[model samples]
Target: MSNTMRILGAPNLYLQGPGAIERIADIVANLGKCALLVADPTVERMLTPQLTKLLTSVGVAFASAPLVGEVTPANVARLAGDHRADVVIAAGGGKGIDAGKAVSRAMSARLVTLPTAASNDGPTSRIFIFYDDDHKLLSAERVPRNPDAVIVDTQILAGAPRHLLVSGIGDALVKRYEAAQCVGAGRPNMFGGRATLAAVSLANVCEQVLREHAVDALAVAGSGKPDESFEKVIEACILLAGLGFEGSGLSIAHAMTRGLSALPATAEALHGRQVAYALLVQFVLENRSAAFMADQFAFYAAVGLPTSLAELGLPKPSADDLRTISSLTHKAPHTRNFERPLSEDELTEAMLQLEQMRQHSAG
Candidate 1:
């Protein structure tokens, strides 16, 4: 691809809805005959039987690889050991799905992601983020292409912990501003090409869908029945956000994840929640208008997303903590995807300013 070329990568087939899982056999059968199923423990207990039954009915031989712990290289290697398959079906949350991706890559097999929760946008994209045994952010590896199929069963998603769906909303909401920042700064997308018009448009629509339906969707989530609003939000969180970030690139909102993961106080928080808080720092760095910041804070409060260091479970961060976060954040390449290069001092100031603004907004 040329330097100026625009790129957009996505799953060849994307499926979502109440019974989307039912279509897995047909989808898998099209891709391969032998399948390796990688699932987290919860998904294994909840959905594996039904999935195996579906695949068995279609005469697709399969083996189960139960994923426990982080998606470390060692863990992925252990999971992939002697379990050859034509395709790997990864089912569950981001870690399990990412593990499946790594396993497929190790075995040189195709990958299909079945996300049980709309927690983040790791499903449709080719990139899979794996961490160390300590849960620190590790290398982000990319497959030759995006997933062959991305199956999102909305009923299963609706049954996920309500906070996870809210976290999805938090994660999806930042695509608009982040994409604009990346494009404005002439940064390459994750694919190392210019952001496509389609990506920018989808990023806008993803934010709009969240703004319109997130509250209503949260109201009905975990009822074990997904409403229309719930479905739209899931699509925004999983597909739109996935495509947007991969095709248009990321900026400060995502860069903050690096720092957040490094800190002990905030490291255990969910990815979407960490990103949501990081978006606030991005707003501060951009010098967003007071009204805009306030509106965002209000939206975050409504959606159960964190708005302050305290809310992120770090009420009183020490100077050393602040330094660690700023230093780590400044080192991230995406931090430069903004309109201007950011200094560690600038990051620290922005975070402190965000805390002040969050306090004022809360009052």
Candidate 2:
């Protein structure tokens, strides 16, 4: 076989520490003189005053905007048109960060991401998953390149809800397995190129670090303390997982997430929480050994990740709901990356199988 071309993409700069956000002035200065800070309502109330004071002290002119809802194209367009700034700093969770990325692209302005939570690996990625008003997955928009910079502050993350950290673990834990599946399937990554050795290796490291330190990280983070384990696991969850998934590829777990968005039952669930349960379904879809599944379920339980449909708020999902999820997943673009094409029937069977194993696994 001919050698496959490999590609990798990453932010121009990445800084992570307990009080990294304190360096906001310096980071923004390097990008431009004027900055537009974007955040959701909650994060805006939490961080805007602090960020504004810091930027003001450094003499950087800046404007602040609050994203009211989902990161839709219309919102991005509004952001690009409403405020004129040299750079855009997206702060908060995934949606806020994604909105900033999209706005920066539309304006052709420089981009910086300051993630307040390790919810998902969205900070360092060039891809943005957009949704409709009802939170249905509409499309995934890819920037021409990754952000100019990504700054993650563990002190901020430590104070976040414990559910967020646990959800991040669920998302990060699947990178290794999904990357391996992509390689086995000979699929192109998000960059539309073959998986690089670096990407796959990082995915391995991501899995190892999470398996070893996730519990410790969760414990300290829940206590509102930034410990070494939180630092390590957050890096694994955000940076490594971001790089690995973008440079390696996506598979069943992520495709299933696209489907989960279709159901109102899962609307309240966080992205990683839904992905957590989807990973078990991915395991079932692969027909993985019972021992492997048990170990995974144990790890999920230890960290309070979602493993059963009940955990995802679908204790008894209707047959119609199951069919809808399966149909959406089957039709998702990412499903084509699987080594074997997954049929809707296969997806339904996997979901059913995972459901059947719930009692047995708990027992």
Q: Model 1, 165-266: lDDT tens per residue? A: 888888899898899999999999999999999999999999999999999999988898999999999999999999999999999998888888998779
lDDT of 2 by residue, 135-227 (tens): 999998987789888999888999998888888888888889889888888888988889989999999999999999999998887565798
RMSD of each: 1.2, 1.4
CA shift at 244, candidate 2, in angstroms? 0.6
Give me the runs in candidate 2 sitting further than 4 Å from their true place: 1-3
Q: Give the runs in model 1 whose Cα sits over 4 Å from its true position.
A: none
Steric collisions counted per model: 0, 0
Which candidate leads the pack in TM-score? Answer: 1
How does residue 189 of candidate 2 score in lDDT?
91
